[model samples]
Target: MLVSLFDQERSFTRGVDPMVLVSPSIDEEMRRKRVEEENRENNSVPLVEEEKCRLQTEILGVKCSLLRMERDIAVMRIERRVEMERTLKFIVQTYLLSLFD
Candidate 1:
């Protein structure tokens, strides 16, 4: 009688315990949930990729503009240097010509 009672108790406990039963349907549902999550993540990936590409494009445009500005500044610097050299040469020539006159 004690053994029968113990067996019944074990059966009841196993029936009530969630870990005791692993149904294939439960596994399929879990797999379905995981697939759904992965699908959601995959769907968002394209938006993230697009945002990354847009940011990269904007960064490249800013870099190009900066490069253009740097080139313009360099050209202006060279032009100023040449102007100064020409002015100095004219002054020296005028002074020498006056001394001769």
Candidate 2:
């Protein structure tokens, strides 16, 4: 009978083997391995969350810095335009004076 074969601590390859037919020692080992793997996966979840938060914070910081740079560049362009206009006016005045002389 199936019970007798299992009771004798023998492995049968004839059909699908239930968990009971497998040795309790092997079953326990498998259960321990599964528990350890689950624990490892669970422990890594927090680390993944922490990394995500850090990356988001870093991205925000970079965006703020870029905005500041853009504003500074706009100010510099306005200043250069003013300087060029003044120089052009001076050149025109000098040319008119020379023509009259």
Candidate 3:
């Protein structure tokens, strides 16, 4: 009986009061909007949590890459030092051979 009061007419009528005509539709639209907004609010909590987890994983990946780069640099430096020592020993040995000749 209460809903009947707000029930809309299906057929178009001329010169009916616009307020009475549009009121039920407006109320229903407002109720739908409110429900959608509540759903969005409820969903934001998990969205925020997912973002936090993604950031932590990215940080861990960056740290691991940095460690790998540091290890590679150290290995290159050792190889360079060994090569320099071998070149120095070859130079000294050649000089001694020339002196004997």
Candidate 4:
């Protein structure tokens, strides 16, 4: 009974799937969409390159700033060491003077 019903349905539909009829047009449309996407990518390539250059420049600027900050930190550290040594020396000299007195 199910086989008979399936045969009747197949006869009603003429045994042709709808996709089989429209597959060529679907394939052409897919190809056209791909070409459009490729064209879009090609057009945006220059913008991508410009953005890359801009980012590179920003990176260079950041690196320079980092180097400058590192130098400043080194100078500050040296100054701090000198100040600490002077303070220690001053304390030592005061203690020595009181001992002599």
Task: Spell out the clash pairs found in candidate 1.
Answer: none
lDDT of 1 at 81: 100
**TM-score of candidate 3 on Cα atoms, chains taken together:** 0.52
Q: Name the best candidate (by TM-score).
A: 1
Candidate lDDT scores, in order, read 0.88, 0.88, 0.85, 0.87
lDDT (Cα, tens digit) per residue for candidate 4, span 23-46: 357789999999999999998999
Candidate 3 has its poorest 10 consecutive residues by lDDT at 3-12
**lDDT tens digits by residue: candidate 3, 5-96:** 44554343667753443345778999999999999999998999999999999999999999999999999999999999999999999999
Q: Is candidate 2 or candidate 4 better by lDDT?
A: 2
Residue 82 of model 1, lDDT score: 100
Candidate 1, residue 96: lDDT: 100
Q: Candidate 1 or 3, higher TM-score?
A: 1
Q: What is the lDDT of residue 52 in candidate 4?
A: 99
What lDDT tens digits, residue by residue, belong to model 2 across residues 53-82?
999999999999999999999999999999
By TM-score, how accurate is candidate 2?
Answer: 0.56
TM-score of every model versus the real structure: 0.66, 0.56, 0.52, 0.52
Q: Give the range of the ten consecutive residues with the poorest summed lDDT in model 1.
A: 13-22
